[model samples]
Target: MKSILVIHHGQGVGGGLIALLGLIAELKENNRVHVLSIFDGIAVDYIRQTGATVTVAKSRFYAKFYQLFIHSDAAYFNIIDSIRNNKSVILYYLSKYYFAGKELKNIVFDYEIVYLNSIFISDWARASKLAKKKVVIHVREPLSRGLFKFKYEIIRQTINKYCDQVIAISHDNASRLDLQHKTTVVYDPVVTKNRSQSEYKLINRKFKYFVYLGGMARIKGFEQLVESLEYLDENIRIFFLGGESEYASHGLKRLVRQNLDPFFLKNKRLIDKLKKSGKIIHVGLVDDVFYYYENSIAAICPFSKPHASLPILEAFSVGKPVIVSDVKGMEELVDSTNGVFFINSDPESLAHKINEMSQVTEQDYEAMRTACMTKYKQIRERSDSVTSVLNRT
Candidate 1:
């Protein structure tokens, strides 16, 4: 059995953590798996439940540093601002590395392979390389172009230099990062055992709303979804099943307060009306998302950027279709057979697609649902594609 050390960014209940949990479930059957988390959150208990040893460094320095860089838009436009951002980044990392090194020193050499679960945890990959251990970096986010593009470039370069292999969750992520020969694409795994037809039937009777199951940030196309509510039938309701990032939420609130209106005014007004009318519901951060998935008509992932969305896979696992943006990673998972696509950030297009899905006959919907499960099964059966490259060596 292989001795594997998994280094993850934090214990948040996001797609990356869910994917890591699925991988750990696979690895623990024949391997000695130990998880080291950078911070403590909801995922720690879940990881422990997977029968793997779990440890937490409990550091917030990196997360805070990241927030500073991403929130400072002026840094991208001005040299002085960029230099200030760089200085803060350097100082924070220097301190973080010192503490992280001391905390991880005893365990860094214990495993044969150090599996970095996300690019955000590259420091662990660096530490593992310095200890002369094999390292695998998983690039779970499309980081080439965004507020933190400069930071992401540094991370990409670091992984290329220090890691033995890189795993991208989707082809789009791999291509975007320019990780050529050393990278492999492993589509994220879905844990199917948790689902139940009886449970679906029971919970499904409670609600008939459409669902959105991720961060409520602007880049997630939440504003667009809100805008589309205007075009939807008055009886149609949407259940938002996740919380918002504090950074994005704060920025959006500030914009609204200032009357700068980053999102369209009509969209904002429509969202308010929907909320008042009880047509828009926010069910923030539930423990069991499958319950929500089971009850909902369908799932929607409208990220403005390219993303390998977990909600799409989860929806498919539960025999539900999805409406996704026609972007790189999203397009890879959805099509006319299983699900429909809408123009990214276009509310009218998304609304039209929603209406089309609403109009699908019961027989046709069943066919689409079957197609979703078929696609999911095909992905799950690719054993060779899912295996870690370190195992090949």
Candidate 2:
């Protein structure tokens, strides 16, 4: 069996982490897998549960310190922004990365392949290359134009210099990164073997809920989902089953963002009002979301940005249809046969689509469920794409 070391940027339990867990689950079946998580969070336990050895590096402090130099995409490409942002701490930030590379060398010698879960773990890629271990990077996010293009150039250079193979989660992601020549499009697999499989009974309630699984970030169009409540039928309720984002999860940051950030402030008021009205239900993070998916009529992913969501795949794996925003990475996954698409960031359109989903006749819903299961089976068939690449000499 191949020895694979998976590196994860473990800040939150977002789709990337879930995708990595799914990959680990698959890899452990035929290979020896070890996960090195950059920081400790909710995902550590999940990673350990996969029967793979996992180590938490306790680097959250270092990661936050590094962020002081390059906080955003603009800082990466704009010289003036980069200088202004890192003028005081550039030396320290650079030193941290240097030491991190040194530390990685000590860890990678025992592994044959170092698999980076996302492009964000470039340091691991570099260190793995230096150790002469095969480096495989999973490019999960899309590379757009403008300053992002500059960031892409940097990423391109990294892959050309360091990575033996690059895996993009979608064709859009591969094209956007301009890495089609060396990139493999592997859809993230859904980990269903460990999930609870209770009998799914359609809830006999007046209000049918649509499940939303992800972080509470603006990019996720959560606020937009809340606003859509104004347009949705009273019988339709949305059940949000996720936690706060990395940016707004801590003390002062959370307090300030929840109070000052217009997005959060507005959504807070609306969510509170809707929760009481029974139009919105917030059931924080759960260990297993199968029950929620089984009880709901459909799953909803109203992401404003281009995202390859694990929740959509997980929902489909359980024979549940999805109402997703018509965005690049997501739209390509679902179509009219198994899911309904709404205009990205448009609350009215989202509500309309949610209404459309709720109104689907039981007979039609059964057909959609069949289609969803078919899609899930197709994905599972190709789930070994990453493992296949790793097994290559």
lDDT comparing candidate 2 with the true structure: 0.72
lDDT score for candidate 1 against the true structure: 0.70
Q: What Cα-based lDDT does every candidate model obtain?
A: 0.70, 0.72
Candidate 1, RMSD to the unseen true structure: 4.8
* Candidate 1: stretches off by over 4 Å: 58-100, 145-153, 193-208, 245-274, 383-387
Residues 136-204, model 2: lDDT tens digits: 998776654544455445556767788989888877777776767778888877655545555645465
Give the range where candidate 2 is weakest over 10 consecutive residues by summed lDDT: 68-77
Give the CA lDDT, 0 to 100, for residue 157 in model 1.
Answer: 73
Over 151-180, each residue of candidate 1 has an lDDT whose tens digit, in order, gives 766666777888888888777878877878
Q: Judged by lDDT, which candidate is best?
A: 2
Question: Candidate 2 has what TM-score?
Answer: 0.84
TM-score of each: 0.80, 0.84
